[model samples]
Target: MGDWYSAEYPSSSLHSLQGYRVFISIAMILGDGLYNFVKVLGRTIFGLYNQIRDKNSRSVLPVGGRTSSPTDSLSYDDQRRTQLFLKDQIPIWVATVGYITIAIISTATLPHVFPPLKWYYIVVIYIFAPILAFCNAYGCGLTDFSLASTYGTLAIFDFKTGYMTLASPRSMFVSQIIGTTMGCVISPCVFWLFYKAFHDLGVPGSQYSAPYALVFRNMAILGVEGLSSLPKNCLTLCYVFFVGAVVINGIRDIVGKKWARFIPLPMAMAIPFYIGAYFTIDMCIGSLILFIWEKIDKAKADAFGPAVASGLICGDGIWTLPSSILALAGVNPPICLKFLSRKTNARVDAFLAS
Candidate 1:
């Protein structure tokens, strides 16, 4: 990866890891997908084998109840839990027809709506998407991870969280729609408030850069230009690293998981490229706190860890609005605390004492 980047774009001055990041990220995603694919395929074959071997083994709802999710492999015996999760499902035909109608409308309107995406592309994506989506959901059920935006990789929404909290897709959808509608109405005002609070708007090197705009613009460019526009050797390196990642995943699987546990997950390691070290440092701090809490009281930590995490995530976000208000109001702290070298500290202490 380093060699390819240095050779192809040697003089390109950008982010510290910009040269290697994209190639490494793609490789990790491709490799992880391949690993999950093989595992799923093996399980499917085994399931088929069991079905053929014995008529009694044919899939049937247990006497107590059926599982809520198709991916709930281990929940078949948890009859009471399954029964509770089972809602009066929206009619299958209604779901099927509604989805088909929406898909058809979307496909028919694509040329007018989004000129870059031909109707055929949508068809192709949707055709393959179902298979991948199901696999992704199943993989997510097994592992609490969601690579939602990543195609050809394992991904899912939080099915466990949804079931635990909402218990109904209908309820979730209604709530989601309501929240989205409200956000659509309110977000512009919030954006304007921040605009007023922060002097530099849309300036390069500003911390408040509109990253989503850049992301969407880049995606649009990629869609319009397609693979032909990729950097000279980038496409070639993508192929190389993708294969390497798959090979590494296969090797890990072949080796006992106990020993292979030492190996870092490709998907996880790739995260630093997008999010950088700030969040990683914050996570480490949170983890240290959790570790201490766990030592202090394992039961409480086990029970409240998720709740505490959710609270912290939400609570951290909300302070921004109040800070923005303060900024807009021209409020300033009376005294500022500053860290300094020994000489600077002594001078400051002496000045304060005087």
Candidate 2:
């Protein structure tokens, strides 16, 4: 349900969207598994395709191209062909080990295990380890062996605290300041623009029956719903708005179309299967191990890590647990049902008052 795309993209520029769509399409193809599959597949398929295409077209070689006679035949080095696999492959392995190990350790060592692990820790691990590993791999020539020792130590330390441990305090502060500015200022304005524009649409009565009504209503609701209620629809709304916006804008830019078709797809109409499945899997994994871990160490049950874990119970786990319950009953989350109930009730009451 995370945003896999964005809006405000240059909708009239197909050339620009080519790059963006490639990224978005690949993300659609591979989400969290992106690192493992996308990189490998791109290198393999494209490399092989080019090699065969070139081999077939090689009746004539370029002026300076090497031509081999019987005695001077080119010797293919099979080891060199495998060198891409050797290109800091160990560091990728080590960093991957670092991420998975840290996730497991963070999961295992966390004090309270009732709720679940926080995404923030996973975020920090992914954010830092890869950058450090890349630097060590290609930039500074640091050995992959050193990467695990250096970055792994930092990751473990960061898990104890909420922030990355290896980054300089000054850099962290600067980043925090910049991030705060964006969230507090820029994000609100972006939301407000969508709210007012969609609110202006003012779909009357049964017109809310269409797919666009879901988009229209949710945008208005998200821009106003209580913080408590917002999370319920936020995941689906966020996914639809972001992806639909990207697609609409991409097509508009590519096709040079007008803005009239920028309607949000219906949430009720789209398959809620993926999100239901995701939440189901998350709950199964969390429930299976969390209680066992909690029982094993009652002494450290409320430690700092566990405290953070408890906080996650308040966030993602909020809807996650309920979604699991509903899924168990063979029901998807009634996103459109809930929206219609609230919005329709309010409209009816307003008519009565008038």
Candidate 3:
């Protein structure tokens, strides 16, 4: 067993190690470092803007109340806190710059491991990064990160149409990934703001499902493989579905909110197809429960329904963290009930026999 493990597993283990390192470098180090840098920068700029605006407004204020004294208008503690926060960000800036420099040097030297930095790739990244970032930020601000998959799909479509013929698959993949990553990194400001707002209202950050990373991963796989790998029929169906979705959305916009209940949301219609029946059924059941509750006692439901729903959603999300940690540690807690196992196995055996 030891000999077999040593000989056969080494190559697989090495590959896994390499993949893990790459993932850590790209997703955790680069992505998170960039996010922190941008977040601090945004916070500093906004803080300065608010301070200046307040000072300017105070200068014109009529002598009265708290505004009578400039020092009283802004507390010393608050000023100290702001200064401390800004001072703390100095290291983050240094770290971000160092990480970027190292990443550039590594990419230049080891293109096979890191993303390539070709001239065309640079141009593509420059052109699409801001556009994707804006759309992603806007979408996340308005809704949740559920729209990330849609944004990613749109980005891929744009890239394929614009640069597929001009660049190699690897180049296109790297550029698109970088563009999308930039969008995700910069858009965290909106997400963080919403997260804090929800947190203040008793919702945990985990309750806010940001499944865009998973969507980005899936799309990246598809991008690498190319459309030619897909079946002709599947491609045709996708085109037809795209047209239908566009038409449905157009009608929804034209009709507006007056007939919103009557019109189906394109996302709502499409999500079931992608995620499948179990999640779709769960969502429908939840919605039905809410609808019935609202119908029964409008005022009571309006008052308490949100709190109850938030608790349930947040509970599930909170539990998922520990569950995930346990899973990573190879301690998967059994979810199945012992009482149901016999009946389930019997049914399965009977079906198989049939």
Please write out the lDDT profile of model 2 over residues 1-354, one tens digit for every residue: 124323342322211222232223222222212232345567899989988988967666456656555434422332332332233223457646867887767755653563555656655765665544443232112111112221111111121112212233334445656877767897687556545544433333322123233433443453466433332333454455446534643454455445533542122112112222443455446545656666887545423334544465457637855764564455754565332457668997899999
TM-scores of all models?
Answer: 0.66, 0.22, 0.42
Check candidate 1 and list the clashing pairs.
Answer: none
Residue 161 in model 2: shift from native, Å?
27
Location of the lowest summed lDDT over 10 successive residues in candidate 3: 10-19
On residues 191-301, what C-alpha lDDT tens digit does candidate 3 reach at each position?
565555544322222434444444355446656777453322444544455556556655765788999578765445444444445546766777788899989998777
TM-score leaderboard ranking: 1, 3, 2
Query: What C-alpha lDDT values do all the predictions have?
Result: 0.61, 0.41, 0.49
Model 1, residue 13: C-alpha shift (Å): 10
Clashes of each: 0, 2, 0
Error of 3 at 248 (Å): 1.1
For model 1, the stretches where C-alpha displacement exceeds 4 angstroms are: 1-20, 41-45, 57-83, 86-96, 131-157, 163-166, 192-199, 222-233, 251-261, 289-300, 326-354
- Model 3, residue 135: distance off in Å is 5.3
